[model samples]
Target: MSRDAASRPARERLLDAAGELFYESGIAATGVDAVLARARVSPATLYAHFSGKDGLVAANLERRFRQWRDVWDEVLDERTDPVDRLLSVFDAVVRYRAVEGNRRGCAFLAAAVELPPGHPGRQWLAADSRLLTERLHDLAEAAGAGDPTGIADGLLALYDGALARLARQAATPGLDTGDPLHRARRMAADWLAGRVPPGRPSG
Candidate 1:
C-alpha cells in the first residue's frame, strides 16, 4: 500500500481526504490526482491501499454508509414505537441536510446515478438502497401494516425524490414547489397514520 499503506493513520488520512472530496464533489468530477493532492499522498500510496479511483470511491462509500447507518440506528433507537422509528428515518435525513454549508445531497444516490451498474461503487449504492428500504420494511412489519411492502417502497421513493429536488434547489421551469423535504416528511407521517397529506389526492 505504497510502503506505509499498511499504517493505520496514513490509510485513515488518505480515506478522510478522499471522503471529503467525494462527498463534496461529484465522484466522476473528482480525480485521483486531486485526491492525492488533498491527501498529500503519492499515487503509489493510494493505489496500494486501493486499486484506483473506483476503489477509492467504493472505500469512501463504505465509510459513508457506516456513518449513515450509525445515525439511522441512533435516531431509531431514541424512539420506542415502531411507527416513530420509521418516521425517524425522515427526521434523520432532514437533520443531515440541515448541516451548515453541506449542500451535498445523498452521496449514495448521487453515485448511483453516475456509476454504471458494473462499477464497484455501485455495489455500495445498491446496498444503501437495500438497507434503507429494509429498515422501513422492518418497521412496517413491526407496525403491522397490511401493505408493508408497498408502504416501504412508497416511502423510499418519496425520500429519494426529496433528495433529488433538494439537490437541484427545488428549481424547475413552469412549476412552483415548496420545500421538498418538508413535504416528504409530512407525507411520510400521513402515510404512517394511514392517510394522505392534503393536496395529494387519494385515489
Candidate 2:
C-alpha cells in the first residue's frame, strides 16, 4: 500500500485488503502477511481488530454477504409482485455479476467450497443462503405455488446452478449455450405456471 493508503482506519483497511486478495486468490492461498502488506498494518493491528486470520476470513465473508443482500434487497423492494420479486432475486445476481465483470462467480459459494469441511465460515455461508431461500419461500407462497417450499427449492437450484456455470459459460463459447439467467427465468416461470412439478415431500 502507498503511504496515503496506509493512513486509513486499520479495520477498514484490513477488510478492504482481505476482500480484494481473498476474491482474487482463494482464501486458503491468501495469507495474513499478504493482507497485512496490502493494508500496510502491523501484525498487532490485525490481531487487534480481528481474532486472527480465521476471524479476518469470517469478517470478509460477512462483509460480502451484506454487500450482496443490499443489492438484492433494493431490487426486491422495487418489485411488489411476489413472482416478480422472486425473479428479481435471480436478476439481482445477474446484474451484480455483470458489475463484477462476471468474474469470480458467487463469493459465498466460492468461500464455502474452498473452506475445509466443518469450518464455521462454511456454516455461515449456508445460513446466509438459507435466509435467501426463506425469502424465496415467502414469495413462492404469495405467488401461489401449490408447494411454496418446493418452489423455493427449485428456484434455489436454478440460482446456484446459473451462478456456478456463468464463469464457465463465459469461458467456453462453443458449448451451444444460451443465457443461463434467461434459461433459469424460463424454468422458474415453468414452476409458476405449474408446468414443472414442485416435487413436494410426501411425509
Candidate 3:
C-alpha cells in the first residue's frame, strides 16, 4: 500500500505530533526522526503528507494561527464595545497565563524566530501578525480613535512587551507578577483619556 493509503490519518497525526513536540521542545531541537517516532509513522508516511520538514513546520504554524484566531473570536464575540473588544485581547492573554502549564511566551513567535527568513512558517507568522494588527485597528476605529492605525500599533507593542516580561519572570517559581492584563487595560484607558501617548511616552 502507498504511504498515504497505509496511514489513513497520517496528516492529522503528523500535525498533532509536530505541535506537541515543537511547542514543548523548540523546532530547531526537534528533528524529523523525533516527530516520526512520536507519531509512530515511517519516513515515507511523513513525506507523503508533507513535502519535507519545512512543510511540516508550515503546517504546524498554520495550525497555531488558526487556534489563536479561534480563541480571539470566542473572546471578542460577546463584546459589543469596541474598546472592550480591543482590551479583551490582553485579558485573554492574562487568563491564558494563569492556566496550569501555561508557558509565558507564544509558541508561534518562538518558532518564527527559529525558522529561516524565507521559510514558509515565516510567511504564516507575518500573516498572523498582520491579522492581529488589523483586528486591533478596527477596534480602535470603532472606539473613536483619531488615528486607529497608530493606536492599534501602540496597543500591540504593549501586548508584546507584557508577554515578554511575563515570560522572563516565569523563571521564578510560584511568583505571580499580578495581572498583566489589568496593567494593559489601565494603560489603554490612560491612552484613551489623553493622559499618555498611544505609544511609549517620553518620561
Candidate 4:
C-alpha cells in the first residue's frame, strides 16, 4: 500500500486491496493473507472490519456492482432518445473500463462462476444479474420493442457474450478479439431497426 492508501480507513483499504486482487486474480486463487498484505492491514484489522474473507468478498462484489451501476446510470441519464438510452450501455462500458482500469471483464460474472450456490457472495452476484435483466427489460420496453422480454434476453445474451469474449482475449496470447462490445451494440441496433432478425447467422 502506498502512503496515501495507508492513510485511508482500514475497511476502505481492505476493500480496495481485496477488490483488485479478487478481480485480477480469481477469488479462490487470492487468499485473505494476500489481501491483508496488500492493504498493509493485520489479520485482526481485516477481521474487525469484515468479520472474515467471505464478508470481504461479499463487500467487494457489492462495491463493484455499485460502481458499474453508477457508471451505467450516468451514461443513460445523458441520453434522451430511448434507443440511445438503451445503447448507452456500450458507451458506459467504454467509460467504465477507462475509469475502473478493468481489463479482464465483468466482475459479477466472475464472482458468479467462482462462488458456489450457497455462498454469501452469491447474493451480490444474483443482485447484479437481476439488475441487468430488469433494467434491460425496462429499456427494451422504452425502446418500443414488440417483445420486451425477448429483446431484453437477447441483449443480455449479447452483453454476456461480449464479456466472455473480453475475458478470452485477456487470457489468450495473440487472440483476435475484434471489438466484441461494438459488434454486440451494432447487432442490437440492427435488430431494433428491423434490419436483421434476432439470432441471425454470422458471416
If both were scored by TM-score, which would come out higher, candidate 2 or candidate 3?
Answer: 2
Q: Which stretches of candidate 3 lie over 4 Å from their true place?
A: 1-8, 94-101, 171-176, 194-203
What lDDT score belongs to each candidate, Candidate 1 first?
0.75, 0.78, 0.75, 0.83
TM value for model 2: 0.83
Ranking by lDDT: 4, 2, 3, 1
How well is each residue in 1-203 modelled by candidate 2, as lDDT tens digits? 77777787999999989988888787989999999998988999999998998889888888777777788888877776556776887888877766655454677877877888776677679768777889888777666666888888888898888777765665566754667777888777766765223443211
Judged by lDDT against the true structure, how good is candidate 1? Answer: 0.75
**CA error at residue 53 for candidate 2, angstroms:** 0.9
Q: For residues 1-203, could you state the per-residue lDDT of candidate 1 as single tens digits?
A: 34455444756877877877877777888888888887777888887898888888888888878777777787777787666676777887766656424564577877878898798887788788889888888777677677778878988888888888776763345444676778998888876775222232111
C-alpha RMSD of each candidate structure in angstroms? 6.4, 4.9, 6.4, 5.0
- Per-candidate TM-scores read 0.82, 0.83, 0.81, 0.92
lDDT of 4 by residue, 71-185 (tens): 9999987877777766777788878999998888788888878898788888888888888889878877666667878877887888889888989988988997597889989
| Model 4 Cα shift for residue 169 (angstroms) | 0.4
lDDT of 3 by residue, 27-92 (tens): 999999999977778899898988899999999889877766767777787676556677878876
Report how far off residue 94 is in candidate 3 (Å).
Answer: 4.7
* Candidate number with greatest lDDT: 4
Clash list (residue pairs), candidate 2: none
